[model samples]
Target: MDSVQFPLSTGTYSINGRKYRRTAYQMKVATDDVAQKFEQFEDTPDVYDDEPSAGCLAPPGLPALKKKIAKAKEVKEAKPESNSTEPTEDERISVIGGKKWIASISVPACFIGKLHGMNRRALNALENDTQCRVKTPRRDENKPCEISSIVSLECVQRCLDRIEIFVDDAKKTARVTHFVALPCDQHEVQENFEVFKQLVLDSEHFDASCKNPQLFTKSARLHLTLSVVCLFDDVDLQRITEAFKVIEGEIKEILNNKPMIADIQGIDMMNDDPSQVSVIYAKVSGEKIQEVANHLNRRLIELGFAKNEGGDEVKLHMTLMNARYVAQAEKLKKFTFDAKKILEDLKESYFGTFQLTEICLCPLNSNSSSEKFYDKLAIMRLA
Candidate 1:
């Protein structure tokens, strides 16, 4: 027997519809290796039974061959199973710090002046007491106190933390401090807060110039000055007077209800006890007089500021009030002129006659040197 025909190639095979002559190399590993290896070679006689049956089998090394076939089937199934596995490492968690605190900065000029002008020791005591609530706290707490004190303490703490307490001998300024926080690679936390602090330090705030003499007394003049008065010719003045009379009639009717009167600053006046007050000023061009009348008519319906019963229009007044006091003065006697009297006279003389040319929005800074009035920041002309 040939060596190739030995048990080395002794495997069962099955035949299909046809057979082909094959070369010696092809016989070793043929294209239809499974069918050739599992071909059955047993003989059997036909029976008359009409029942269907499974295919016949060969007994030549069939047990060992079935084991090899089953092993190959398992390997084929495992290729995709191994490829479908996922990674098995643990994920991580990260932490983010909190937001930085911010506060605006302004000098205690107004509040401090109010305390000093009235000689109110209690006010000072109150102010100091309020400040002390946050200051001079129990040292045992070992914590910073007061807003300002905390800011100052933070500066000192920074220096101490870095162990840089050397003060400059010539300049008399505190030494610079540096700290290397181990967890924070880049000082991003402190840098963010520093940016916020700088913004507050650079913001625009009310300031007082000590060189100005009129800032605190009754004569205390502000930098910005506002003047409002009724302007009209003798003819237009008649129209205003007539309109005033018309509104006065309605006011008299409203007064019939007998509203409560109060001594407001020694001046008797009707009080509505309004919860909130809003100042409204409507400016119209001369060409828009009809439109202005229509607008006022709607306003009168809402507030009933008109007479003639069903008419919706209200009286048009140029001046809202004669004189207005924007700032409170503790020492009125110190002013050169009587501000109260000036305001009263200005109010009494006010008659709605001024032509609406432009509306100005101004900012009051402080008392100006030339006019002793509040200065304007920038005038915006109404479009």
Candidate 2:
């Protein structure tokens, strides 16, 4: 009991990382003591924070500095950024006042991942400072190494395994009509979504501004958004539907052996900061998941209804929350959530696996209004 010892006096200091990540919302602050003590459990014996010594997380020479600043609200004590999770005040959808048909695949709701070992004090500091964010690992650390060497031939063999996820920014693109997708049921994944939602809402690490619990996502609305399609004409819908029919048997054939299974893991932000998050999604992974996505995207692109955004490369993610509105981009930017901290805390979380059985064609009403984001237009199942 109480085996550790603290020789230095109780005071405050600050910690800063290398640079600000553009994809995440973060609040920066100083000090590894008081608040940081909780985030960084192990501390060096150095009396001052001005110079980095051994066993520190930051690089050397970048000393922890003494700085006095007003204590912002603690995560637990701070009120939620949004009174309700269902954000109704700001509607940030790109296409509004109408619905479009698209193809998409649905993954099970419980497929979210899980993580552990986060510093609470770090979360508190981030919550207080509002300008800093957690830095993700470099390319290889996040994904399997793309390049491999053939030792026998003494030659390097590979292209970097990367998913080129653009913002669907294809100019001169026709109307976004139908998308291919795999759908999930609320009964299968709602309970976990609710739990994760509540955890984010109650955690002190989160900034609750403008967040609505209702906006998290309805169980009925859970599904993976595959690709954005462009319709361009009244006859396009028929063509798109027929194109799907053309390859429906093949897709089912791929999934026919058994229900496709995958895990729904932890959460991540679409951008660097959580505060300006347009979408929050759970990481998903499984065997041959890439093959399924590739097949679907190939067929859709072949018919000229969808763009080959990633080309046999699929980003397997399930969108959990959104702050988008048809008419409110600037307003939404001002309202940031603590998705970063929440993601860190649950980095090792695993919601469970999804036995994906079928794919569907659904209609998108408005990206802003997600209560019933899509209506089931058609369904095709594996034999």
Candidate 3:
């Protein structure tokens, strides 16, 4: 009988003058045995026997095999060490100082006025449980709440989580709460509007029954509304501002870097009957002005901040008078003014043309500034 011989290069064995190929099972068993030997060697000292067993003989590809095994062992050893020391997602903390943690959350501006029992209950519970310092913005303030320092970092995180849930719920049912407009703030334009306003107040054709001084728009607050939008909070305001900033270049391009001239001529009522009008406005017209207004309306609608009431064309007009400004008690009866006579008298009234300098995103029903301009959330300069 011939001695069995294994050929390292061919991966075959010769026995009793016969040759046989190594099966997958045999290769797997050999690999397992080698791995077990390597593990046992790692645990023991570096001492080696002068003479090795026949089964422990190195294979033809031992150098490459040793390198691969060493790399795999290193990776296996490092994995547990890394996992044991690093924190999990839930365990992570945003430390501000020694054992102090801080967390913040955004609350929509509309949430202040719309707060219900559920919101109050949640907020009260958070305050009582965490004893955390909760700083929320006022109704008029566009800012996020700053929550900091509780028994532990987890408490602050919990406070933020609850607030976020409340804010998310409020956002789902939010309405259009703002508008975008091109402010007619030129000194010349304001003086012209003041003249027009005085004319309406003193004209014999103006109806005495509807001539409440409060019905007139402030000269400083005069503007041609582009579109109305729903801005729930500072985050929404920031997003819309960024969106406008991106398209501002397009608006500037349309104007060709020249100051856009808006022609304010003629007087009109929003309703056809002029006899029972709730809104009186000055007609705004100019090729470039209309283009910019239409572009803004379209972009705002596409961004989901505004709705498309009808066509893409934005009707440009600066509101001169509104009956909604009437006293709260009389407003319930739906007070309106007779604008028919005033319309006939000022039909072709030119309130003068002025350069369009800036467009503003302003909050509705906000208190006017000292200069009598509506508080602007954002302003885009055209010239």
Candidate 4:
């Protein structure tokens, strides 16, 4: 009922336009006699791995050897040795960050293109200023700053396409995207991606260290950094002070409430320290205090600087330090509660009001070497 025939196998497969050897072995062993033959064949095959014959992709002749030599040459030519020196971290920033970042207040669509143009200008400047061998494409890819773009009709359409919802002043909504994929433009994603790339690069101070040398490092722990900033409008100092009263009321009420739990951190609400709260409450002044605060808070949210408890609008304040530096950096982490709950508790337990009008750019020096000094760049008053 069973009959079978085995044939000698020889074939070749092509991969990446090159041929590879293919050999097949087939036999049927039904009894002890055939089993012994199979065992003998295993011990000594008709074709050994070292043996070369016709149709084999690789052979022991000058032709095969020439092919191997050609391949070696190709690889050698493909990647030329570096005649140019690689730039240090600081140089990379200088090469990229030389352009000024212009942020638009009322116009949102002019954001990306303006950044791109500035980046191009920065690269051109770098090329003119340095002897470093810079490639045009590499320069094109450099995006040193984040700022408003010179808007075109097409850019406006794109911005409108990406907008999920609209918010009027004094309104809260939950449609915010948890995360946005950066450089959504596919045509120049890599080039435009650098708009945010340098901000996260390893600090220049510790790049020289062979081990544990970074002046700043990422941590798994999370904490809240808030900024209290004030911006004066079309008014004098008296009006600014009056505006501060409104902001002050909001701050005091939120602090007095002191929620039982921070919905975001899922931690004790009131047990956090007072100094941290103090840092968040410090007053700073500038014409654009509100604008700066809004920008900072928006950036923190965009970059996930802190887990939001999903309560109210994030208060405008400089995030002085993270939880990792809480032990040494002014010991401020103890003061920030579930600001949402804290404010709610304060509103219910005590009546506190705020009239905020100025923005302060303060230095947060965490004693840890792994954390670097950051500038609180701007401050604006909220209308």
- Model 2: lDDT equals 0.53
Error of 2 at 31 (Å): 99
Worst 10 residues of 3 by lDDT: 37-46
Off by over 4 Å in 3: 1-175, 327-333
Candidate 4, residues 1-383: lDDT per residue as tens digits? 78786644445679999996464454655557434443222222344456666673545587988989999999989986644433223322212132221221221222324322565674344333332222221223432222222322233233322221221211132223112110111223223223212322433422222112121222211122343222212222234345435544454343453321111111122324532222212122233333433444454444323235543354422122223333345544342312332223222221112223333232333243433223323333232
For model 4, give the 10-residue run with minimal summed lDDT.
177-186
Name the candidate, 2 or 4, with the larger TM-score value. 2
Q: Best candidate per lDDT, number?
A: 3
**Model 4 — TM-score against the truth?**
0.18
Model 4 clash number = 53
lDDT, candidate 1, 193-289, per-residue tens: 2332233234333111111222222211211112211211233234434543454345334345343121101111112221111111112223343
Give lDDT tens digits, candidate 2, residues 1-383: 87899565444444583442122123444555556322333343335545554464654444433121223345535754543222112231111112211111111111111100154453334323332222222323322212122121111111111111111222233345556566655454767877777877777776665246644666667777666676533345566667667677787677667667877877777788654666778888877666878777777777666777676777777877766541253564344455666666866665657677666776555454555546555566643
Best by TM-score: 3
Give me the runs in candidate 2 sitting further than 4 Å from their true place.
1-171, 232-234, 325-336, 366-373
Query: Worst ten-residue run, lDDT, model 1?
Result: 176-185
Instruction: Tell me how far the alpha carbon of residue 250 in candidate 4 is from the true structure, in angstroms, after superposition.
Output: 20
Better model by TM-score, 1 or 3? Answer: 3
Predicted structure 1, TM vs. truth: 0.18
Clashes of 1: 25
